[model samples]
Target: MKELLYNLLHGSSTIVTPMDALQNMVIALILGVVVCITYRITYSGVAYSSKFNTALMMLSLITTMVMNILGTSLALSLGMVGALSIVRFRTAIKDPRDTTYIFWAISIGMGAGSSNYYIVIIGTLFIAATSIAFSFSFKKDNKYLVIVRGTNECIEAVRAALFSIYRPCKLRAETVTDDYTEIVYQIKLNNKDQLIDYENIKNIEGVSFVNMVARDGETLG
Candidate 1:
């Protein structure tokens, strides 16, 4: 048992044994799962890509493997660095936060690969906790999009309905033809209990159609 623990901690100089390699791989995988769960819960909208999430997990595993392969050889580590430089990534990350998560996952995987289990587990916990903490603000600013179609006279009558809510509303888009007028509004509410005055708007003089869509707080329609 002492010998097994010693191998895991100090890392092997010659070849990776079953116990050392398995322990690192398992740690990398568990941390990868933690990263994915944190991302799913904290990301504000449905715009997130599943493929990107998958990549994050794979990146962790790959990094762990790379560290295991390098072992204790400085020359091998330097060679691996040069080899990594030749690889090019074509994918573009739309969200900066995604990039941060990817970087974090890679770092965690590297630590695990190097058999630094304490750093891998503790660092993953810290970053995941920080991300989840930041997500609370987005939850408070719930966003909704409302599209109202009506005649000019109908729209004029409903102007008061927009201002009646205890929230901020911005006029996002307006389209008018000879027969019908359509207006789209972007609303931000401080609380979930504060509902929009949808019925009041629909009850206005010339309203032909009223539609409301609830979206992930970060997305705008």
Candidate 2:
């Protein structure tokens, strides 16, 4: 019984058994499932791509399979790196959060593929917990980005009124024309709903038009 238990625990390196390979594949599959679910639940961006999420699961499995093959030979490791280096990614990822998910999927795959099952499980749980904690603890601020196009007559008054309501205001850009001017301002507000009060600003003595955009910016949309 002692010899049998010892062989079971220490047999991975010497064992070319189908069971061992199947075990590794199963671990990779479980890790991929976890990664896919986490990516789905924690996603908060403007546009969610099911295709990208599916890719994350497939990447986890692919990384695991590659690592398993590379583990058997040093020559394969160098060749694999060369082969992977030749591949170029041309997709433009506009959202930083998407990049984070990609990295997380890769990390989990690498960990499980190398037989570090404990690390993969523990690390993923820690990350998921931290993300949930941060989501509840952090409150998104109310802010607006204002773009104005008008004659030069009431530009100063508009700026003054904006500065009075918003705490930190920045003049992003300005373009002057023969008869009109285009101005953009990054404005943070005490109350987001208060932006409705600014409709009258356009009706002000010489204001042309006032446009308000949420400060969250564009993401993956």
Candidate 2 lDDT tens digits, 7-116: 55444333225665567678877767777777777666557888998998888788877777766554566688899999999999988877887888888778877778
> Model 1: which residue pairs collide?
none
> lDDT for each of the candidates?
0.79, 0.74
Which stretches in model 1 have alpha-carbon errors above 4 Å? 1-14, 48-51, 78-83, 137-139, 143-145, 165-167, 170-173, 190-196, 199-221
Candidate 1 lDDT over 113-212, as tens digits, reads 8888887798899988888888875544467787889998778666567767735788889999999999888776665444535656777778987876
Least lDDT summed over 10 consecutive residues: which range in candidate 1?
212-221
TM-score of 1: 0.72
Query: Candidate 2 overall Cα lDDT vs. reference?
Result: 0.74
